[model samples]
Target: PNSSKVQAYVLSRKMLDKIVLLASRAQLPLEAIIPEDDVWGDTAGELGNFLLLQRSARGHFRISAFVEHTIAFHRSIRSVTPPLTGVPSSELQMDSLSLELQRSIDYLSAQLRQVQLHQLKVCCDEE
Candidate 1:
C-alpha cells in the first residue's frame, strides 16, 4: 500500500435500495448505513488510542485503527496454508498475522505522529 490510500465505504445502489425497501416494508427507520469496521472502531475509540486484531474466519485476520470514532486504518490478512496441510498451523497463522499487524501499526504510527496507543486487543475463535 505504498501508493497513497483513501479510505471510503461503498455500498452498491441496488443493494442499498433493497435494504431501504425492506426496512420500509417492515416500518423500520433506515437511518444510516455504517460499515462493520466503523462500529468496531467506534467501540474501541472509547478506550482512547486502540489497536484491534480480530480473526474473521479460519486463516483470516483483520486489523483496525480508530479515527473520528471510526476506522482509520484497516486491513485484512489471510494466512497461507502450508503445503499438504488442510489449514494453516497455529504457529504459521500467528506469524502471518503478527507480520501484517506490525506493518499496520508502523503505518499508523507514521501517518499519525501522535499515535499513543492505549490498548491492544486480540479476538480469535477458539480452535
Candidate 2:
C-alpha cells in the first residue's frame, strides 16, 4: 500500500499534469498556467508528500505546499539548516501571469459563446 505522502505526491503530480494538458489545449504555456513555486515544490518533495494550491496576487495561482513538508522532513531526518529563502512574493509578476492565463481562458470562453450564438442564429433562421 502506498504511504500517505506517496499518495499525496502522486495525486499532486497527476493534477499538475492534467492542468498542463488543459493549458496546452488552450494554447497557454504551462508556466503561465502554473506558478514556478509549485514546480519547485514538486522537485523538492521527491517523496510525493504534501501539496497545496493557492491563489496569488491578481488571482494568479501558486504551488507551495511541498516546501513546508520538505522542511519538516529534513528537520526530522537531520539537523535543520537555515530556512530556505526566495519564495516569490504574492505580488511578484503575478499580475502579468494572471492576465495571460485569464486571456487564454477568456478567449476560449468567447469562442464557445460565439459558436453558441451562431447555432442559435442558424436555428432561428431555419424556423
Q: Which candidate number maximizes lDDT?
A: 1
Maximum-TM-score candidate:
1
Residues 17-117, candidate 1: write the lDDT tens digits: 99999999999999999887767766753575678876654555677776555456767765533221246566765577668878988888898776566
lDDT for model 2 comes to 0.36
TM for every model, in the order presented, reads 0.68, 0.21
What C-alpha lDDT values do all the predictions have?
0.69, 0.36
Stretches of model 1 off by over 4 angstroms after superposition? 1-6, 55-59, 80-88, 123-127
Assess candidate 2 and give its TM-score to the true structure.
0.21
* Predicted candidate 2 versus true structure: per-residue lDDT over 71-105, tens digit per residue: 11111111112111255344534454445444534
CA RMSD for every model? Answer: 4.9, 23.3
On a 0 to 100 scale, what is the lDDT of residue 37 in model 2? 40
